[model samples]
Target: MIMLSDWHPDIIEFIISKMQNPRILRYLLENTEDEQIKKAAQDKLKFTPLTAQEQDMYQGIINYKQIPGLGGFSDKIIKEAEEKLRTGGTYSVHNSEFLTGANISVCLTSDFMEAVENDEEYSLRFPDVEKYDEEEMKFYNENWHEIGDVREWEQMGYKVRTYRKMRAKELWNLINVCATYSAEPGIFFIDNANDMTNAKAYGQKVVATNPCGE
Candidate 1:
């Protein structure tokens, strides 16, 4: 027997995850001649997060370890991660509850934060880099040989390098390479047919329900 009753958790999961919630039944009932297409799930707009509440929710989500049973790491890292995210934007990973948890699988090359301080010989590295002003010099000092902030240049008609993990159609390496640096992203991919996830709301954060949704 196929159990067909619509459930609340499933509905909530569907709303946030954007994977399983079916609007087809509603569409059929509303537009087609199917009287038998009764509402499979009750209206879930009520369960949605309010703007202020969502802000607060994102706040706690960025620090998932705060949940009583979800112990993971220090709040400092959570804070740092959030602060960094403020500049970096989402790094995919929108599969659970938060869009950009604390990791990533892919990111634009320019997503790296400008180096505020770095030590490297300028002559052998970039002789032309010396012409820039103090702040630019400091940035060069901080990120020599490192990919130029091609992220911004990407918009200004310059070529940009992107990274990938799986051998799909893309450029650069997958985001895991960031572990080599100290700024890796944690991701949670989602798809309608195969998207059943159980995040404890534990750890320092959970994945985003829908990254682009935000």
Candidate 2:
């Protein structure tokens, strides 16, 4: 009998190396011994790799989605990530400029959020009404990542959701040109709260900002 509560990777791996039972691999619950999990992760080793992607690099990939020209690292990115979730598609991201300063703010609306949740193609791209009134819809918007540098208790999507639109590679390139220092876009999703909660009162149409809100 193996304890299933342990999370120790080495211990579990050791046990799996010895055990050949298939049923034991099934029905693995949490709080169980690390050995049990090691057995499971190893049993499915062919699927889920023993490696994990760095969050910052992943965050960079996610941040790219916020950029104006970029298409949120392409919807297929998430698909690929999910498919390779086991293989661990994570790759290191290296770029000093991308993280030099956290500026150029951006925000997301509830409607956009709905799209991302329901529609696979829907982008959390900022959708504004009065802000784009007669203005170009390209990078013609303002930055609206959040109400201020001071925000709390907001219902957030995946942590990456804050940087939802942006992705690692694209952000690296933009950093080369220094979008972080200029527009200083802050990335976040609070549109549903804004429209429903009346945070900024942009009104029904919707509005967006490149690095700052209107």
Candidate 3:
């Protein structure tokens, strides 16, 4: 057998798309230094049938970015963040029970939280505001510039929406649902996080936090 470990990370990653052996995928996940290989292993594991123990291990890889006791080395709580870098939100996880057990903290903006509460489709990273109402449109146009660099939005001519205040009951209901499943997602004011960050001067904004809220 040509050992998977003998191959380079890039080769192993390419094979990951064609290979289905759980054992080899697990080995790559546990041993690989290249994040591309690690993430590819994770993507394969998501569809491959796993034992209970293996499922737990897979969830750990998904949440590996911010293991509770570990430091902030990875970028985010799920593959969605990784997907953004690779494909620009073309492939994103819509929902997952796995995230509840992944043990990663998530932060949602007011507009996103409201959309989820109303069971409407929305995106913070790849925003589309044309479907929104005039009020929401105005809200986005007024605040989008303050939260992040306005140059990109202006060039795209897409005014990203934000909520001045979210409905309390809707917000609490979302919280309760996550809490019930022990999928505790911490809520933070996007505007507040952006306003307080020193990175604003550098044209960066705080979109999310680490497991420790750093």
Candidate 4:
């Protein structure tokens, strides 16, 4: 098999043009002085078609009600947990245990201490739940714009929502659940993770960690 290092410059350019990773495309667009490469990146970013694998992953995330393996908690899950805490109901650890029992450890992050200490609104943007059909996907691709925040999406006529502010009491209750019951949902300092990540230079943020915190 031909090695990737042996690929021609034209072949590599073609591969980069087909890439779906917006971060890499955006980096090339902004950092490269080559007009042709910049145009290619811009075109790619304007209409990123989801690959079969990406479509399946999105479906799995929706179906499982959680991201499989070690990852940051999606805003939907976080909102659910917040609701449970607010209602004096304990959040369920059965899911975490189920994954752990299957040899798949789950870890999640929250700015609990930061929220409590700063008395900040522990708000999170709700995740997109719509399953797009081919036509819908085409429409989305045609209108796709890089949204820096949920508010920008909303401004672009996309439906968006945010979770209510989480208080110290609710966060403490979550901590209590972790302390007394399952230790599967280990606390991850996401802010620190992103701050220290070298990926930041490439316009990427660290969002998850492996089971062993790698």
Residues 1-214, model 3: lDDT tens digits? 1111111112233334443344455655676554555676677664333456745544555565656743443544356444433332232221333333333333435555566667654322323576767876786778764544333564657654432232334334434443344334444455567778999899877755655552
TM-score of each: 0.15, 0.22, 0.30, 0.36
Go through the candidates in order and give the clash count of each: 20, 47, 0, 0
Specify the poorest-scoring 10-residue window by lDDT in model 2.
1-10
lDDT of 3 at 95: 31
lDDT of 2 by residue, 1-214 (tens): 1111111113223223332222233323222333434444345433223243444455555555557754446766744544454335422222323334333333434443454455332222223333443443332334233322112212222111221332222222222222233332234454443554553454432234434432
- Candidate with the greatest lDDT versus the true structure: 3
The ten-residue window of minimal lDDT in model 3 covers 1-10
* Candidate 3 TM-score, true structure as reference: 0.30
Model 1, 135-191: lDDT tens digits are 766755675434332333334443322321211110111122222333333222322
Model 3, runs deviating above 4 Å: 1-97, 104-106, 110-156, 159-168, 180-183
Question: RMSDs, each prediction?
Answer: 25.4, 24.1, 19.8, 23.5
Error of 3 at 116 (Å): 13
